[model samples]
Target: MEIRDLTPAERRVWRAFPRGRRVDFTDRPPGPERTVRAKVLRALLLTQGAADGEVASLRMTAARITGRLDLKYATVEHPVSLHGCHFDEVPFLYGARVRQFNLQGSHLPGLDAATIHVDGVLRVTGCRVTGLARLGGARISGALFCDGAEFGSPGVATALELNHVSVGRDLYGVGLAAHGTVRLNGAEVTGKVNLRDAVLDAPGGTALNAKLLTVGSNVSLDELQAQGEVRLHGARIPGQLGLTGARLSEPGGTALDVGAVVIGSGADLTGLQAEGRIELHDATVTGPLDLSRARLTAPGGVVLDATSLTVGSNVVLHRLQAEGRVELRGATISGQLNCAGARFTNPGETALRASSCTIGELWLREDSLIEGAVNLRRSQIDMVHAEPGAWPDVVKLDGFVYTALNPRRPARERLPLLERDDDGYVPFAYEQLAASYRRIGDEAGVRAVQLARQRRHRGTLPWYARIWGYLQEVTVGYGFKPLRAAAWLVALLAAGTAAFGLHHPPPLKPDETPGFNALFYTLDLLLPIIDFGQEKAFKPQGGYQWLSYALILAGWVLATTIITGITRALSRQ
Candidate 1:
C-alpha cells in the first residue's frame, strides 16, 4: 500500500500524530497523506495469522499509537511500537515481530502460546506481565524478557530460554536449556521451582548455574529427573529445597552440588534417588535438614558429604539408607543426628565416618550397625544409644546413657578382670559383689562392703604394720595423767626398800671377823626416811617399760583430733 501522493486532509493528520497507538477516528479516507498514514498504522498493529500477508517496511522517522494497538491474529511486516501505551488486557503477539522490537513501557495481561515462535530478539524491558507467562509449547530463538517484570501468577516456560535475559518471578520448567547463562539474579518467586522432568544444559561446567539467585520461598524439583547436572551452588533460598522425587544422575563429578549455599529455613532431599554425589559443604541451615527417605547411590566413595556445616537444629537422616560411603567430618549439630531407621551398608572399610563432629545426641536404633569402623574420637555427644549394639565398636556409645540397655557383650567380653595378685582397683567388682551378695541375701553386707571398698586403698600396707605412727605422738615424761599409774609403782618400790632395811636388815654380827655390818649400812643410807634391808629394793630394776605404752596412747589420740579439725575447715573453703 505505497502512497504515490496524498490528499490535503490526509497530510494534516499525518503531520500531527501523537506518541501512542492511533485509534480510528473515522472510516472515510482523510485524503492522500492521511490515508497513507492510516494504512501504515494498520500494517504495524495487525497480529500474525496463517493468511500469508506481508507489507512494505515503513520508513517513518518515529511511529506512535494514540490509542491501544490491537495486533491479534495479524502479522506485522515492519518494526512497530506501542511504547508508553496502556493495554487493558493481553494483546496477543504470537509469531509477530519486526527486525528490532521494543515495548519498554507497557502492561500485558497474559501471554498464550501454542507452538508459537519468535525469531528476532523481543525486548519488553520494563513490561509488567500480569498473568502467567505460558510458553509451555512455544519455541523462542532469541532472548526473552520479563525481567524486572512482575507476574501475578505462576509462570511455566519449559524448554525455553532467554539466554542473556533475566526472570523476575518463579520460572517453572520441565526441561529447560540456555546456551548462554539465564540470569535471574534478583528474581523473587513466591512458589516452588518445579524443575522435575527438566534438563538444564549449560556445557561450560553446569547445565544450569543459578549462582547468587534468590528464591522467595520453596524450590521443589521432586522427580524433576535431570539428564545433565543442576548446579545451584550459591543460590539463596528462604525456604525448603524440595527434591524428594528428583533423580540427579549426571556423571560430571557431582550432579547436584549446592555446596557453600545457604537455605534460610532448611531443605529436604528425601527420596531423592540420585546416582551422582551430593555435596553440601559449608552450607548453613537455619532449620532441620531432612534427608529421610532418600536413596543416594553414588559411584564414588563418598555419597553425601556435608562437612563443616552448621545446622540450626536436627539433621533428620532417618531412613536415609545409603549404599555408598558418607563423610560428615567437622559438622556441628545443635540438635540430634538421628540416623535411626537408616542403614549405611557400605560393605568396604568404614561405612559412615562422622568423627570430630559435635552433636546434641546420636540415635542408631532399630537394628542398625556400622558394619565397619565407627570413629567418634573427641566428639562431644550428649546422649546416645536408644538400643544395644549388635556388634563391637560398630556402634559408638560416646554420650551419656539415659536408659541402660542390655550390657554390650562385645565391650564387656573384651575387658580384663582383676586377678588375685593384682594390686590395682578391680574392674567390674561392683557388679560382681552385688551378684554375690544377692545370691546370699546379704543386702546389708553388700552395701556396707561396697562403701568400704570404694574408700579403701588397694596398693598400700595394712595399718597394723605402722603402729609406731600412733605411738610416737604421745607425751612420755612423768606427771602426765595418762602415765600416773607408773608414778605410783615407783613410789611403792622406794617404801618397800626402807621397810626391808628396818625389819630384816643384814645381821650386824654377820661374818664377825671378815664381813661388815649390813644392818648398820642400811640404817646409814635410809636414816632420814626409813630403815632398809640389804636388798636391791630401793634401786628398783628396769621396770619403766609400762610407762612408755601410756605415753604412746596419749600422744596418738591428740594427733588424731588435730588432723580431723584441720580437714573439716579445709573442706568448707
Candidate 2:
C-alpha cells in the first residue's frame, strides 16, 4: 500500500481517500491511467489512516477496477462512493460491515453483499449489472435506492435477490429495468417499497417475487411492465399497494398473484392491462380495491380469480373489461361492489361466478355487458342497483338474496331476471323478488311475481298435477287474482238462471213444493251446500235434468278449486 508502488490511477485514488475527495478520470482515455487494482482499493479501505479527524471516504469516478474486491467479515469505517466505475469482477462483501455503500451510475459484473450490514444508505442508482445483484440477508440501516438501475443479463435466472433482507427505510427502484426475476421474499422494509415505472422481463417466469414480504409503508409499482408473473403472495403491506397503469402479461398463466396478501390501506390497480389471470384469492384489503378501467384478458379462462377475497371498503370495478370469467365465489365485500359499465365476456361459460359472496351494495349499470352466464347463487347482497337491461341472458339466482333494488321496477320487468336463471323453477328466486317488491310497498308487483311463480312451477309438475295447476291459474291466477274467481262465479250464476227460466221443471210432490222461482232454483242447483225446497221437490226431465246435473258438478269443482287456492296462498304468507 506504499505510495511509490501505486499505479497512476491507484495513487490518485489513495491520495483522495483520506480527505474523502473524488478522483475524476473520466476525461482520460481507457488505459492504465484510468485503471486501478481492486486489491489496492481494498488495502486502502482496511488500512489505518493518520488521525486527521476528517471524514474520509473512497470516492472515485470513471475508474476500471480489476480483480474481486473481497471484504468478507471485514469492518470498513469509511464510506464508499464509486460513480461511473467499471468492475471486471463481482465484489465479494459477504458479512462485511460498512458505513455507507454507493456505486451510482457504475457498470459492474455483479455484486455479492449477502448478509452485509450498512450503517447508512446503500445505493446502486443508475448502475448496470450484468450478473446477479445478490443482497440476500443484508441489513441496511438507511434506505436502499436502485432508481434507474439495470440488473442481470437476458438469460439469467435471477437478477436481484433481497430475500430476508431488512431495510430501515424505503427501498426505491423507480424506473428499474431487470432482465430476470427480482426477488424480495421474506424481506422486511420499514418504509415504502417503490418500483414505479420498472420494466421486468422474465418470460415464462416470475418477474418479481415478493412472497411473505412485509412493508411498513405503501408499496408502489405504478406503470410497471412485467413480462412474467408479479407475485406478492402472502405479503403484508400496512399501507396502500398501488399498481396503477401496470401492464402485466404471462399469457395463459398468472400475470399478477396477490393471493392471501394483506394490505392495510388499499390497492389501486386503476388501469392495469393484464393478458393472464390475476389471482387474488383469500386476499384482504383493508380499504377500497380499485380496478376501474382495467382490462384483463385471458380468453376462455379465468381472467380474475378472487375467490374468498375480503375487502373492507368498496370494490370499484367500474368500466373494467374482462375477456374471461371473473370468479368471486366466497368473496366478502363490506362496502359497495360497483361494476357499473363493466364488460365480462366468456362465451358459453360462466362470465362471472360470484356464488356465496356477501356484498354491501351491488351496482350493475345498464351499460354493462355480460356475454356468458352469471352465477350468483347463495350470495347475500344488501342492495342491488341494477337496471333491467343490465342482466345477462343466463343467471343462477337460487339462494341469492338482496334487500333492495334501484329504479323500483314492477315485478313484470324484474320477473324476467328470475326467469333467466338457468336452474328452472327456482321458487326461492321468485320468492326473493316478491319479498323485495313487498318491502317497497308494491302490492301489485308482489301479486305479479307470485302469479309468475305459479306458472313456472306448473311447468315442472306431472301431467295430472299440471292440469290442476293450469285450471287454478286460468280460473283465479293461483289465488293471486281473486277478482277472476268472482267474475267466473257471477258468469256461471247468470248462465244457470237464464237456462232454468227458459224451461220449467215439474214438481214431484205438489203438496210440499214451493213456488218455482228461476233465480232461487238456479241458486239451489249451483250452491250444493244450500237447501232450497224448490230443488228438493222439482223433477227436471231430458236436457233440463242434464243441465241441473252439470250445474251441481261445476259448483263442486269451483268450490274445491277456490278452497285449495286460498289455502295455498295463506300458507305462503
Candidate 3:
C-alpha cells in the first residue's frame, strides 16, 4: 500500500503494510487516539472486502480502541472478533452480513438499523450498549447471545422491533433489553430464551409484543416486568414458559392474551399481577398451568376468560384474587384443578360460573365464597373419559355467609326453596325440600319425590328417611278430639244422675227405700255431709253418704272410656 497524505494526527498510527505487519504504540498518549482508531478500522474494512471468500478467520485479539467505528454495508466474509474494545461514539455496523460477529465486553451503542442480518452467530456478551438498540426485520440465522449486556437508557419511547427473525439456537437476551420495548413479533426461536432480570420499561405502551412468536424450548422470564401490556397473542411455545414473579399489566383490556396458543409444556406464571384481562381461551398446554398467587384484576368484566383451554395437568390458581368473573366455561384440565382461596367478587349473575368445564378432582376451597351465582349447570363431575381423574361434585364454601337482598319468594312458586332453578341447591337443597314439605304438612309432595327417587333407582333414598317422610306427613295434619269427648261424657253423666235415681228399682213404685227421693230426703236431713265433703276428705257422717262417692267414681270411669275410644278413632282417620 502507498503512503498517502493522511495528516499528522492520523499518521501516528499508520496502516499495516500490504504483506501483514504490526504497528508500535509504546510512547503514545491518548490525545489523537480516535483519529488513529478510525484509520485502522477503515483499513480493516477494506482488507475484509478484498479477502472475500479467502479469509476464514479475522481475530483481533485484545484491542482497545476509542473511536466511532463505521462498518456500514461492508461484507465481512469471515468471523470478526472485537473482544475488548471501548468506543466513545456510536458504532455503525449497519447492514453488515458476517458469518459470526463476536463483540464480547465491548462498550458500544446507537445500533439503530434495519435488516442488519447476522448469519452464523452474533454474540455480544458482556457489552455495555448505551442508547436504544433496534434490530427490526433482521434474520439472525444462528443463536443471538447478549448475556450480561447492560442497556442504560431510561427505557421509554424506545422501539426495538425484532420482527420476522429466526434464530437457530437459543436466543439468549438475558439482561438484554433491560429497559426497552422488545417487539419480537412473528419470530422463531429454536432453543431456550432466557430473559431473566430484564427490566422492560416501555412507557408509551407495550413493553414486549411477542405475538405470533414460536419457540422451540423453554422461555424463562423470571422476575421480568413489562410495565405495559405483553402482547403474546398467538405464540406457540414448544417448552415450558417460566414467567414466575412477572408483572404484566395493562390499563384497558388484556395484558397477556395467550388465546389460541399451543404450549408444549406448562406455564409458570406464579405471582403475576395483570391489571387487565388474561385470555387463555383455546390454548392447549401439555403440562400444568401454575398460576399460584396471581392477582388478575379486570375492571370491566372477567379477569381470566380461559373458557376453552386444555391443560394437560393441574391448573393451579391458589390464592388468586380477581375482581371480576373468573370464567372457566369449557376448560379441560387433566389433573386436580386447585383454585383454592381464589376470590372473584362479581355480583351480576355469577362470580364463577363454570357451566361446562371438565376437569380432574377440583381442589377448590370450602371457604371460597362466591358473591354471585355459582352456575355449574351441565358441568360433568367424575367424568371418566373427559379429562383425567374423577371430576369433583363437592365444592367447599367454608365459613361462607351471604347477606344480599334477594327476593323472599323463589323463582318457581310451585317448587320449594330447594327446587327452584335459580337457587343454588347443591346437596342441601334437595335435602331441605324433603324436610320442609314434611314440615308444612305437604305429605303428598314429600312422599312423591321419595317414591319417585325410589322407583326410579334401585336404592336411591335411605329407608329411615322414607319412614320419617311418612310420619312427618301425619303429625302436621292430625286433629285433637280425645279431650273434647271426655268433656261431653261428663256432661251426659250429670244429666242422667239428675233424671234417674241410683238405688231405686225399675219394677218398684215410688215407695222404694233408699231411692233418689229418699237419698235427697236424707241429704236434706244432713246438709252437713255436703258442706263436709268440700273441706274434709272421707268424712261421710253416715253409710248413705258412701253412695255419693260410688256414683262419682262410676261417672269418671265412663268419661275416660268414651275419651279413649274417641282418641283412637281420630288418630286412625
User: What is the lDDT of every predicted structure here?
Assistant: 0.50, 0.93, 0.60
Candidate 3's residue-wise lDDT over 1-573, tens digit each? Answer: 224655453443333322223333334454553334654665655563323234335444344465666777767665666665566677676776767778777766656545677788887787777775666666678898878776646744554557777788888877665466677888888887788867677654777788888888888888777767677778889898888888776767677778888888789999887777788888899998998888888764888888888998888878877777778888788786776676666765466756676766565454444555555555554421211111122332211222111122222332332232353334433433334455545555554444333332322357876554343232222112234444543454454344334433232232432323433433332233243222122223344355445545444443344444456445534
When sorted by TM-score, best at the front, the candidate numbers are 2, 3, 1
User: Model 2: per-residue lDDT, tens digit, 1-573?
Assistant: 698999988988888888888999899999898999999999999994633977789999999999999999999999999999999999999999999999999999999999999999999999999999999999999999999999999999999999999999999999999999999999999999999999999999999999999999999999999999999999999999999999999998999999999999999999999999999999999999999999999999999999999999999999999999999999999999999999999999999999999999999989999999999999999999999999999999999999998878767888888778899889999889888888888878888988898889888888999988888787778877778878887888898889878888999988878889888888788778887767887989999899899888777767777787788678756
lDDT of 1 by residue, 190-301 (tens): 4445555443343324444555556667666666555455677777787877777777666536777778778877888878877667888888888888888888876436
The 10-residue segment of model 1 with minimum total lDDT is: 472-481
Better of 1 and 2 by TM-score: 2
> What TM-score, computed on C-alpha atoms, does each candidate reach?
0.46, 0.97, 0.62
For candidate 1, the per-residue lDDT at 522 reads 34
Per-residue lDDT value at 484 in model 2: 82
| Per-residue error (Å), model 1, residue 26 | 31
1 versus 2: better lDDT goes to: 2
For model 1, the local distance difference test gives 0.50
Q: Is candidate 1 or candidate 3 better by TM-score?
A: 3
Judging by lDDT against the true structure, name the best candidate. Answer: 2
